[model samples]
Target: MNEETIKNIEDEKFRRLTGVKRSPFEKMLDILREAARLKKAKGGGKNTLILEDRLLRALEYIREYPYLFPYKSKRWGQ
Candidate 1:
């Protein structure tokens, strides 16, 4: 519901799935990267918006399905 509650749940599930903790920076990056990818897919002169919608859903799924969350390419909080 609320952002903080969602964040706590997200963190818990993320750690449970990946066996590691996620940081604020990583979360922000994930949100930003996912946004950029979807925007480009939509505005880059393509008509297949289904792919864009699927990418958006995949990003949302990444938020819920923590195991699918990729490891941060850079170490966070280290």
Candidate 2:
């Protein structure tokens, strides 16, 4: 989910959805932002997804498929 969508969610529900509380999520976002800035300084192309969206997608993947992470899938012949 994006920032606007997340802002409308209740704290408890959001925690349930992402498995993280709002404050910790914001802190994680800040860390991601700093890492992105550092990466940009090293001269890479712009990311297709913004930091917030990327964080959300990561959290979703972790919550949905904890066992599969690092993400080894049959599609990759792993």
lDDT, candidates in the order shown: 0.53, 0.85
Off by over 4 Å in 1: 1-22, 44-78
Superposed Cα deviation of residue 16, candidate 2 (Å): 1.3
- Candidate 2 whole-model C-alpha lDDT, 0 to 1: 0.85
| lDDT of candidate 1 at residue 62, scale 0 to 100 | 66
Residue-level lDDT of model 1, residues 1-78, one tens digit each, is 333543556767756543446664356557766877889877866444443244334455666766533444234533
lDDT digits (tens) for residues 5-24 of candidate 2: 98899999988888899999
* Best-performing candidate as measured by TM-score: 2
Model 2 residue 36 distance off true place after TM-score fit, in angstroms: 0.6
Per-model TM-score versus the true fold: 0.27, 0.79
Task: Please give the distance, in angstroms, between residue 55's alpha carbon in candidate 2 and its true position after superposition.
Answer: 0.4
Superposition-based RMSD of candidate 2 using all C-alpha atoms, in angstroms:
4.9
